[model samples]
Target chain A: MTEGVALLTVFVLAVFVGFEVVSKVSSTLHTPLMSGANAIHGVILVGAVIVAGTADEAGVLVVALIAVVLATLNLVGGFVVTDRMLEMFGARRPEAAAKDGAE
Target chain B: MIAVWAQVCYVVAAVCFILALKGLSSPKTARRGNLVGAFGALLAVVVTFIAYDIDNLGWILLAVAFGAVGGAMGARRVAMTAMPQLVALFNGVGGGAAALVALLELSEPARAGITRPAGFGDDGWFAYSPLAESGGHTESEILRMVDLLSTGTLTATAFTVLIGAVSFSGSTVTFLKLQELMTGRPITFPGGPIVFGAVLVAAVGLGLWAVATGSVTLAIILALVGLLAGVLLVLPVGGADVPIVISLLNAFTGLAVAAGGYVLENALLLVAGTLVGASGTILTRAMAHAMGRSVSSILFGAFKGGSTAGGGEASDRPVRSAGPDDVAIMLAYARKVIVVPGYGLAVAQAQHTIRELVDLLEKRGVEVGYAIHPVAGRMPGHMNVLLAEANIPYEQLLEMDTANGQLRTADVALVVGANDVVNPAARTSPGSPIYGMPILDADHAGAIVFLKRSMRPGFAGIENELLFDPKTTLLFGDAKASLTALVSALKSL
Candidate 1:
């Protein structure tokens, strides 16, 4: 009803964009990339918020709130962990170089 | 309808996610790219709270805070060895959340601002009172509501719930397997495939029924069955292959979120979810290829009784055993060395010790590089993280192909706490489980020294034929202890 055709167009285009973006990644970045993408879907938090905001029943509200908690974990935990992993990749470079230089 | 400004904001957030993924692929911009994605996630969350007249604002904020603190703590505190488990757990919760949101949306149909029929929801659906009921409306109004509840949206909702539930349970099982809380070996039952197929067909059938009739009961049943299907899907996969399963489930969760986006009519969710779904699929395929297996074979291989069956018994074949000093002397005199690190190294927490030994080898003018198999530890890129934690230079880490080429000219292949990656069985024996897998050419080296706790076969339970090679020397001990001895032994030299 709400321009389903338009949404379908968006979906189709997004699929191609998705495939194109990550098509050339090296295997070394696979773990962090997976984790980062996992965090991005945590945007489902938006859906949880919208539903929780409108729920008039206690049962629905409780369930929506639980959804919020879980999505928050997925979102926040995913980013933090991914960042932590990338930090290892970033933080050690100079130190490693320094160690090499010292040796 | 979303406001123009909010729509623009969502678009911006979605673009950020794309850039984040692109940046994450390469090493140079990866950290900065993650930060950009985080900023976008923060922006989208803030915009949602502002754009919607959300009730229970205080409670929702509290829940957000509670989850944030817990997630950050867990992410920060987990050991590097358990990174795969943590990722699996976080992925599970995300998937579970998507399913629950879709379920809640199904229960509150009138929130879409349509009048429900009097007997509506009485037929085994969630029997909840409509949130905003308008007085007696015309037949046209009813028809309008029907138009709003298009088959398209309903179908998307059904897809969301089923796939989300599957991703949730599958990720949890993967986490358990990775954490060693459950047996890493494949678990199969009599008529397992038949039951799995039946339940899968039932889930798809129920999903179509839910879409056709808009029955919440059918949807709920579909979710339960989907959860069962997820568990059954991953149960037969052996431990070494669980990472691929996790990647596959990550893709599943992404597609579920994409469907949920369609149901909610949100462009940002649609785009972000689609990106993950697509990218995760490719990533899963790449990981499987790295292990020399197909996705289907990894899942159902145990049932076929081919890939995972092997004797766990330690081989009594006489392998030339050596002391740490002998191995150290071998390493100290070598002109070049390649170290093959694996899950055992991570398990024994010997990465730092190995790094120390590598450094000492380099100081002795012995060229050293780590031959990193794609699925090296529990997950792709796992050993890099572990070795990086130990301050090992990134330059010293070589991809499997590069390491293989170097192995031919190397004097010694010092395999520490690794078995399968260097196992020549992947190449020589067609009947072997890992026959087609691309293994590190450790056997190409002039001499091979293996550090082992025992003669136990690798995670696939397959024996390594290279162990019987006369050029191979076994130094029996814990990886850390053996590495420490080698480090000191080299120092004495």
Candidate 2:
């Protein structure tokens, strides 16, 4: 397979895989899940890194640097908030109640 | 050699990301799941630092350190109620970064040429830049990424810029409204659609012109226009619908990030970005479905605000007002009470009070449960999270169907600071903007005691007909204060 075709194939597969993985998330966890997904896309930092590494022009480097900082903020902040929020959901007290319908 | 090593690290990071998502499915493992995702991000960043040696590496390191500290502090300090706005802001910056990635990609080739080392010839996705200057001729040639940035890739870049601008600007509006920095009510100009249309047309027109003429200035102008269009698109949506807007913008950011991955030809970026896009699309749809709104209606509804939609004399209609003592007597006497909460509950920080009330009722042998409408809180499932913070057991939170079914036999449905969710207008009033929207059917209860601040209409600006029902009692005050009063009154009884 050609290089571009391989990437396209992976992209398509990831789309299906993502849908399958997220579809079963309980309603209560939706906010954390959305925020988690938000953080993962912060992987655009990969592109930012490539840009910062390759660009020789000061203008492009500055732009790339800005991308790196902003993407880092997104990655770090999104994950941290999601973690904090999910910690509230981590209690084991709710499981027995969850087994009953509308206790 | 470096490329191969970078790819290996990327593979490990990708596995971590997948495991992170799987862990998020169960609430018990959610925090751990977030940690796993963070580990993936850290791994990717470290790999990049090792593989790429840029000119200003020290400054990059400094900026990254500052960003990490700032982000950690901000996220840690934000109150739980302010989480929606914080997420909106963070989500916007991510999109902005992706857009910047496209710009840097465009400028890189114009400055210094990009070249791939040996062993990339068999790489399917590798495209060489055509602008490479002739060097020593050998049996093999290195491929530069800048050569691939031809007019053919302009469409991808334009798409990235457009989507990123929309997500950034739209989420900014979302943050402002959630933070109360902007009026949550829909704001409309006189020629609203026309103005929005003009901005959109200008963006598309300039974007194509930039692509055709290779004018970076026109491209930047197009991005600005796209930003204007984003604001216009969201300005007229009521605050209650902002969750749907935020969800949709999440999808937009995901797609833009995916485009950035394509521009950079990074498989990990592509996989992660596309995964987010897919999940975000599902989330947006689920949020819309919960409210019984079509995606288009939620986006296009020009909510006219409370003043215009509710000018009638529903306020003067003599509904029986019950004091806290009287409401407490009714609550104490009920065999089954169902509680319904909404955005007002969150705004008043009354979830803990509600929990106390439930405990008090349960001690008296009254079965108290929460009726959880799908779109009750600011975001989908937000109410569950909000209530969960109060340590309300998960089983007590009933979905709309189960709650409505139980309401048939319920002695009293106590609605706390909820307005539109329990409104019968969605069903009975065809002319209502929220017509055809699914509601909690609180009107089906044997008796409904509504705890509200006043006779004001809900976030949708439409009056709730259920408030006027003969069997309903209006217990007026702040939700937390009213609940506290009820607790005291019930205790005295």
The most accurate candidate by TM-score is: 1
All DockQ scores: 0.63, 0.46
Give stretches of model 1 more than 4 Å off: A93-103, B110-148
Evaluate model 1: give its lDDT. Answer: 0.85
lDDT of 1 by residue, B1-493 (tens): 6798999999999999999999999998999889899989999999999987789999999999988999999999998889898988888888888898887777654444553343323342224333235345444444434543457777788888999999999999989898889988888888988999999999988887877666667788989998999999988887688888888898888888888888777888888889889989998998888888998888875425655555577888888999989999999999999999988898888877887888888888999999999888888888888888778888899998899999999999989888988888888888887888888999999999999999999887888888999999999999988898988998898
lDDT of 2 by residue, B1-493 (tens): 2488898898888888887887877777788888998999899988987876556787677768877787788898987778888888888988888888887676544343333332213243244333346343221223433334444456667778888888889889989988889887788878888998888888888777765644456667777877888898889877578877887888788888887776666777877888788888887777777777778877775355343455322477778889999999998989999999987888888887888788998999999889998778777778887787778888899998898898888999999988888988788876677777788888888899999898987776677778889999999989989998999988888
lDDT score, candidate 2, position B399: 90
Interface RMSD, candidates in the order listed: 2.2, 3.8
Q: What lDDT does each candidate get?
A: 0.85, 0.78
What TM-score, computed on C-alpha atoms, does each candidate reach? 0.93, 0.89
In terms of TM-score, how similar is model 2 to the real structure? 0.89
Candidate 2, B-chain TM: 0.90
Residue B115 shift from truth in candidate 1, angstroms: 8.5
